[model samples]
Target: MTASTAQDAVTAGFIVIGDEILSGRTKDTNTGFLADYLTAIGIDLSEVRVVPDETDRIVEAVNALRERYTYVFTSGGIGPTHDDITADSIAAAFGVTIDVDPRARAILEAHYPPGGLTAARLRMARIPAGADLIDNPVSKAPGFRIGNVHVMAGVPSIMQAMVDAIAPTLKTGRKMLSRHVDADIPESRLAERIGEIQAKFPETLIGSYPRTSDGRFTTQIVIRARDEDILEQATAAVQDAVSITLA
Candidate 1:
């Protein structure tokens, strides 16, 4: 899992756990950042789930995602508050014991002044047994990686720092290449041709996004593929399809 092979396609799943996000009290910005970051590193983000800060919900999402994807990243519920149950939930999902990790405690101890690491703050040091710690440069409270699951902080800054810390350690696949062609035509008019083009290039992904410009409908056809030559062929086919539709 640490090295990329020709046949390997690295994929990731993301879980956002927080009741505040579900209630719209806190906006979740980590998903988009993670998606972009993973994509840039040649890891496809296959799925994303936003679950409330409930232990069962978190466990369910973690188990489901960890089983399906090459890697699973969880953000939120790792804080020191009463509702922060991600560490315990992850332990439950993996059927492992969770306790204050000495390494994490040491890191926190160094970050916090004497007696500042209160009982509540000590919660941040808890980590599932047999897990590796992910460095959190923004904050001293470290994230943990258990199995394929990486449990990170909910805060955007801290989560971003954790991602940076873990980026170099992750395996990456062939980078996905993309090309887009904007056409001055309605999507419906090019749907059939696009379908034909898609069938011709089964290895490539073709998507059509429609929008309005000056009250006129237009479409942007985007083609993606791991192989650059295939991507170019698919994009050319899409362009031809758009031109034919216009004709």
Candidate 2:
């Protein structure tokens, strides 16, 4: 299968591999980062899965998610350690051979100079055939594109950098925009009217987030749509329902 993104409503998924993540050693900031960034660029994140360092689990998640989404991004397990098996797992998932590619090797060699291409470092050079290279400014070790999946580092800064390098090449959709307003009224008081506004503005998404703190219930309503005009209209209706204005 090939990796494909659309000029409209591009749906994407993510695979995060690391025993550390599953064991709660590191709380994931990558998912939130990617979610906000991708949404701004018009790619909707459909799903995210965090798996262990096990190759079989990684392979399965990669294969399944890639086929179901327009694009798949994997983070973590691309280091020089023995447990960094993302590349090999991805290769196995696609039923492709895992070996150091000349292009990737050349790139690594260019970065590392004389003794830079050590065995451990060379392991980073193994990429699936016909994959594209993703620039890694943090370290010269590159991320590879196989099918529709872009595999990058687990480190937040490096992953963010890698995303910046490749995002321009993606086909993005019209960005979904939103506006929010908070009211001290209970959500139950606005439930019926909120539902009515949602029905009237079917193209827009209306969400009511309610929280109880101390002794009062507060609600925040968010209106979202690909079309700014529709989003504004929904926002107006929401304000009318709650009889509250937002500055």
Candidate 3:
């Protein structure tokens, strides 16, 4: 099945664009934020890809993901430097002309003084031909949504603002409910039984995370499902399989 056409009815893809993230010069904290945000709001963040500040790669990844998911959110490469090529790459990906958007320009102009709006800063005003802007309250430079894709700033705070701005525009599905069980048994000991529970409850997603603290190895089993009853069933199955306390 295609990425968008997968079992989940509501899904999203994330594209992290920047050489900094690829080179490990800047740690990527936005992806996790997006995942948590999307998950909380009933959207599954199903796919994620990190690309450098290369135009062709950005264009390729954007095109592929836009076709594959219900929505594609791109972070980074929308800054005011020579390396901020996301806007141009996205325009190329949609086969549209890139030009200074008057609306975006107005926002940037309002944010910066006349002399402060340098040519480099104006670069953030460039938007694809057919797209609506996603507001950025943190930094006046706005992000835009084209087709199924929503582009946003790479900075954690700004990207989060853009996401909030775009949330109302999306078609959200049923919210996913999560239950975490702190199991006294080690992950290896409960692996087989958890596999059985997963097979028995196919609609829910179950994951076991192991951690060792104070020389004790324990596992945290997380159960996620849209239906509370099903989530309870999954939780009960895991609890019956091993000794666990609700978290």
TM-score of each: 0.97, 0.90, 0.90
Give the per-residue lDDT of model 3 (tens digit) for 1-247. Answer: 2233244458899999988998899999999999999988889898999998899999999999999889999999999998898999999999999899999999998999769999999999999999999999998999999999999999999999899999988887778888988887679988988999999988788999998877999899999887789889999888888853323
Regions of candidate 1 where Cα sits further than 4 Å from its true position: 1-6
Q: Write the per-residue lDDT of candidate 1 for residues 64-167, one digit (tens) a residue.
A: 99999999999998888899999999999999999999999999999999999999999999999999999998878999999999999999999999999999
TM-score of 2: 0.90
Question: Which pairs of residues collide in candidate 3?
Answer: 4-68
How far does residue 108 in candidate 2 sit from its true spot (Å)?
2.1
What TM-score does prediction 3 earn?
0.90
Model 2 backbone overlap count = 1
Model 3 residue 239 distance off true place after TM-score fit, in angstroms: 1.0
> Which segments of candidate 2 are over 4 A away from where they belong?
1-7, 212-214, 244-247
Worst 10 residues of 3 by lDDT: 1-10
Give all candidate RMSDs, comma-separated. Answer: 2.7, 4.0, 3.3
Residue pairs clashing in model 2 are 3-148
Q: Cα deviation in Å at residue 222, candidate 3?
A: 1.4
RMSD of 1: 2.7
Better of 1 and 2 by TM-score: 1
Give the number of the best model, judged by TM-score: 1
Please report how far candidate 3 places residue 55 from its true position, in Å.
1.1
